[model samples]
Target: MASIFSRIVAGEIPSYKVAEDDRHYAFLDISPVAAGHTLVIPKREVDYIFDLSDEEYADLQLFAKKVAGAIKKAVPCKRVGVAVMGLEVPHAHIHLVPINREADMNFFGEHLSMQPEEMASMAASIAAAME
Candidate 1:
């Protein structure tokens, strides 16, 4: 069965996309710890990050850097933190979170609630900044 991330990549599940390349995909995290929280993942659907090949891992990281920059530009933050907690979903993914404090990146922190329109607007802003 396809993981949810794969489903999103395949267009079976809707996502507020931030950026994507031929080998990777990035989109907003609906249950975000902070505004502009995004998830970056390989399109190949590996179960773990280390399971990716050397080249694929490098490419995914590079792709994530681009998306992180865009998220920073579109959202106010002290820095964009990276986290890889590959347990929530079966697929490998990086969490790019905008933070002003360490707690802002806490995996157990309270998540923000945003309206669909707000998420869509934020996604557009981040996507534009990626250019």
Candidate 2:
């Protein structure tokens, strides 16, 4: 079965895309801990992050770094926190969270409800900053 991230990458579902290259895709999280929370995933549907080949794993990390840099430029944050909690979704992914404090990276916190327009604006801002 295709994981949800694969579905989004395949256009089976829509996403607020922040950035993408041939191997990876970055998009805003619909249920976000913070305003600029983004999920970066490999285009390949590998179930676990560590299970990926050496080159694939390195590419994912480098891809995530690029996304985090763009996010820091776009959002107001002290820094971008990287988290890889692969249990929620079967697909390998990295969460790029904008954090002013450590608590901003808390997965158990109440999520912010953002409109489609808001997500689109945030994604656009992040993409622009990447350029």
The residue pairs in collision within model 1 are none
Give lDDT tens digits, candidate 1, residues 1-131. 99999999999999999998899999999899898999999999899999999999999999999999999999999899999995879999999999998889877867899999999999999999999
What candidate 1 gets wrong by more than 4 Å, as runs, is none
Local distance difference test, each candidate:
0.94, 0.94
Candidate 2 local lDDT, 20-127, one digit each (tens): 999999999999999999999999999999999999999999989999999999999999999999598999999999999999999987999999899999999999
Clashes of 1: 0
Task: Quote model 2's TM-score.
Answer: 0.98
Let me know the TM-score candidate 1 reaches against the reference structure: 0.98
Question: Total clashes, candidate 2?
Answer: 0
All candidates' TM-scores? Answer: 0.98, 0.98
